[model samples]
Target chain A: MKLGVLFSGGKDSLFACWQAIQKEEVACLITVVSQNPESYMFHTPNIRLAALQAEAAGFPLVEVETAGEKEEELLDLKRALLAARERYGIEGVVTGAILSVYQAARVQRICRELGLWCFNPLWLADQEAYMEELIGAGFTVVIAGVFSAPFDESWLGREIDRRTLDELRAIAQKYQVTLTGEGGELETFVVDAPFFAQKIAIEEASKVYRNYNGVLRIERAGLVAK
Target chain B: MILVVDLCYRDGSLSRDEFVAPVERILCRAETPFLTRHYTAVGAPDLKSADAAILCGTALMDTGYMEQPELFRWLLSFERPVLGISSGMLALAAAFGGGTEPCCEIGMVDVNVLAPDPLFAGQEVFPAYEVHEHAVRVPGEFVALAASDRCVQAIRHRSLPLYGLLFYPEVRNEWIVERFLGLAARQSP
Candidate 1:
């Protein structure tokens, strides 16, 4: 089946894409860029890099801009899916939703309306196991945003490796936060993946952190040979 | 051990992670032992060994399991506790001469308990995650236990431990699966 992935330049979305590529043809990467930094459904931090990631993975990208209103963002997502179906002839849509019924249901409704099958490969996944698999799968994921306590500016731009995962596991157990950041406690960006033909090398970035809230703003990045 | 039956389009398909793994995680957290097998590969020995069975859901667009109702005929004679979820519910119903109607519900919805059963005991109304394209037309041998405004949300056999839920309990409703497991544990020899 030809499918379009809802890419967010995040680990979950990219991991979902990798899984889809194994079983089906990933026809395109669909991204809905929200102007609202706190968009309910779409991932905000480093979302623009989805195109680069799509290019690295050799998949077509369908990008759409949204004003990020409460319910209006869903319309923009629908527009992106429609565009992907028209351009790439995708039969279904794939999502990276792990535990958010709010996000999953909205996407499911939209896909049903579009007559496209919706598949959330990460739906209700075990968070710790999922994080372990993400690292074990050779995905070089870095912290791009943090929104809760116990995460300081030092965590920004930190690659999620074994040591980081071990620390995250301890923090997750202590702070009662999800290890995979499914609760909007954190955001991640993938610099490399197993399927990537090239790796993303960050040239310049800036960090803005205050009171446990921060973002690793990638000022410049380009694809490099793996 | 609990037999988790994968009802996806094919064994080891992408949908298994979505449908089967979550249930396994729930069982794992509960410290319960479980074994998973695709519906097509389930032999008599599997049914014989399993203390209980949970038939997992599939993607809304995947109906490959429903086409082969004969594969689930064992569900009719097997008196062991069984819980079917979403597409698995359709399979359980089909094995007992139940059909389905076009009733689509995708998202969180309010489910009202219509009949008192241990699966939903003491919970009059609750929210459930539903991702089904059709609703089972409650089989004659089963009684409707709960419902949403749109369609029946749950059903169970009149005498057997067989049960079917049209919602995915693994999502924000792991308690349902836990309750089923508890019920199974009590009924086990």
Candidate 2:
């Protein structure tokens, strides 16, 4: 099956893309840039950097712009998927929905309406195995945004490794949060992955903290040889 | 009053909570009270005190039986209402002398309910999320309740309140769990 992946420059999306490549032909990576930071549907943290990530991974990427209003942004996403189908002749779209029914159901409905198959390899997948596989596959994931308690400014710009995963598990157990941060508890960025021809090198970044919530901004980054 | 058994493949370093989280959230949404236990502790689960028990899915198949022989025996001897899902369904089948056939059917597949059951109350046919290479065969003591083109999707004991499903109800929605809880609450003393 030829498929388009909903890429967000995050671990879940990229992992979904990687998983799809195993069974299907990934036609292109689709990224939706939202203007509204508080958009409920799409990921806005470090989203603009998706272009560089796509370049590093050596995949064709298509970008879509959305005003990011709740419920309204889905239309923009639909338009993006449709465009990918028309341009690349994609028969399906893959997503990295581990535990978000809100996002999965909406995407599934859109795919159904568009007559395209919906693929979610990470849906309800074992979080531990998923993370282990991601790491074992040589993907360097990092925490890019923190939205809940038990996570302070120090958590910003932290690379996800065995040690960090252990700490996150402890914090997740204590706070009763999703281990994969599926409940808006956190967001991630992929610096390097198995499929990448080049690796993302973060030369400059900033941490923006506001009222127990914070986001790590990638002010500058470039792709370097792997 | 519900018991959720985490049927995760114990690798000695991971918590099975990730597999149980969806079931937890379903109970939370339905306002149904429930308790959770790991598969290792299934040997002596407090089944008498709970209204029902649910065996969640796992990534590994051999991890289910090889890790806990006593638990498998307990489930075979269990008389209370039990629901098995995916690898859980495989465990139930193994305990009943029925074995799994190596036939992979992963992803959404159409399922047809052969008879009226509480788990699939209102639905006659629906799409289910399947992720298994081995499909369970119907034991003599149990009857097949639902089936897809490739495999038997569900099974039920002849006289006991036991059920097994090859699909994950926690995927698209928790209607299956909600219905099971309703039946359980009514069956509770």
Candidate 3:
């Protein structure tokens, strides 16, 4: 079956795309860019870079803009799915939802309304095992945003290597946070994946952090030959 | 050992991770032993060895398993404790002459327990995750255990340990699966 993934330039969505490609034909990557940084449904940090990731993975991208209003964002998502179905002839949609019923339910409804099948590969996944697989599968993920405490500015733009994962594991146990950041405690960006023909090179970036809330905004990035 | 049945469209399908793995994870955390096999691949040895069985759900649009009701006829005689979820529930009902109706529920729903059963002994009303396109008609040999405002949420055999839930208990309701494991342990040798 041909499917379109809801890409957010984050590890979860990209990882979901990887899984979808392995099982079905990932015809395109659909992204909904929200203006509100506090949007609950969409990932905000460096979301514009989804196009570059899509290009690296050799998939068409369907980009949609949303004002980020509560319910209006869902309408924008529906529009995006319609566009994907029209352009790519996708039969279903894939999501990276891990444990958020709020996000999963909303997306499920939209897909049902569109008469499209929805699949959440990472739904209710074991967090630690998922993180281990993400790293073991040669996915180079870096922390893009941190929303909760126990995470300082030093974690910005930090690649999730073994050492970083170890630290996160300890923090997860001590701070009551999810290891894969499913609770909005952190956000991640994949610079390179096993499926990527090229890797993302960060040319210029800036960090905006205060009181445990921070984002590594990628001001300039380009695809580089791996 | 618990037999975790995969009810996806095909063996090792993409839907396996979404439907089967979560339930396996709950069992893993509970330190329970299990074996998984696709519905088409299950054999007599699997039924003979499993102390209990949990038939996992499938994607909403994937009902290929429902087309072959004979594959599940074994459930009628297996007699061991069984828990069928969502699409698995439909299959379980079909094995006993029950049919499905057009009742679509997606996302979190409030379920009200109507009967006194160990599965929901303490809980009266609770939220559950549902992603089914149709609701099973309560089989003649079974009684409705719980329900949402729209449709029946749970059912169990009048005398057997067979049970069916129209929701995915792996999401935020892992306790239910754990409780079922506890029940299965007590009923098993």
Candidate 4:
């Protein structure tokens, strides 16, 4: 199937595209950049870097803007999907919606109305196992933001690996949080994944931690040969 | 929070959040705490502490699907306010003597409210996200609450606080979830 992935430059979405490429043809990457920092739907952290990620992966990228108001932002995504369908002849739109029905259901609804297949390759996946699979599949993902207790400022920009997974598991068990950062515990960014022809090199970044929440702002980044 | 069981197939196609995250967001908005478990972890004993239980849908089960025999037995015997979602609705139907027929819905479906029920309060037509290849034919004493052109979309037991919905309530259907939470809270000991 020819498809467009709802890319966020996050581990889950990148992995979703990687997995989809194995079975289907990924035509482009569709990204909805929410102006609302606290957008209820789309991920905001490290979002500007999505274009670079798309370039590294050698897929055309579509960027749409939304005010990110609760239900209204879905329209922006819909517009992006429609454009992808018309421009690239995509038959489906895939997302890395591991566990957010708030996100997945809306995408599915839009795809349905537009006659596009909605594929959530990471839907209902075991969180811990999914994280492991990313590392095993040679995806270098890192923490981009942390929003809750037990995930302090130190977690920002930390690479997710076997040890990190173990620590995350322990914290999750202790705090009853999701191992894969579901429930807004944290957000991730993909530095390198198997599909990337090049890796993202962060030139300058800063960790902004305040009021019990923090994010790693990527000031400058460029794609370098892997 | 309610206990949502992740019933997706384990072949790496789907994740638990396809079930857990949407419901979790709803409950979080309602200030409810939800606990998640794999379908295999849901023994009858675990059901004791939960205020309610939700069976989640799966991608792999779009065709013919069946639960573990013991799990089916336990679900049949479970006496609580339960909400069956998508594939979960099929499990409920099968457990209650109803069965699933092959269906091919995979997008937004408009289900007209046939009767007034707590889950569909004040809503005439509930638009829900559906991704199922089978629709539940509800059993005896379970009234149909809503339907799309294709099949029955919602069902409820006449007496007990048991409900099954082919439509995903976790997606833009907070009323359905809030109402179910209200029923669960009222019924919980």
Q: How many residue pairs clash in each candidate?
A: 0, 0, 0, 11
Interface RMSD of each: 0.9, 10.2, 0.9, 5.8
The candidate, 2 or 4, that scores higher on DockQ is 4
Q: Where is model 1 more than 4 Å wrong at Cα?
A: none
What fraction of the true interface contacts does model 2 reproduce?
0.04
Q: Compute the DockQ of candidate 2.
A: 0.07
Q: What is the lDDT of residue A201 in candidate 1?
A: 97
What digit string (tens of lDDT, one per residue) describes model 2 on residues A1-226? 6889999999999998887777668899998899988886786599999999999988889899999988889999999998999899998788887876568667766776687767666767767778888889999998999999989999999999999999988988899988898888899999999999999999999999977599999999998988
Query: lDDT by residue for model 1 over B8-32, one digit each (tens)?
Result: 9899888889999989989999999
* Model 1 lDDT per residue over A110-222, tens place: 99899998888988777878888988899999999999999999999999999999999899999999999888889999999999999999999999999999999998999
lDDT of 3 by residue, A61-141 (tens): 999999899999999999999999999999999999988889988998899898888999998888888999999999999
Q: List chain A TM-scores, every candidate, in order.
A: 0.99, 0.97, 0.99, 0.97
Candidate 4's DockQ is 0.11
Clashing pairs in 3: none
User: For all the predictions, what are the DockQ values?
Assistant: 0.81, 0.07, 0.78, 0.11
Instruction: Give one digit per residue, the lDDT tens place, for model 3 in B56-126.
Output: 99888899998888899999999989999999888998999999999999889999999999999899999
Query: At residue A203, what lDDT does model 1 achieve?
Result: 97
Q: Candidate 4 chain A — worst ten consecutive residues by lDDT sum?
A: A120-129
Which portions of model 2 show Cα errors greater than 4 Å? B1-168, B172-189
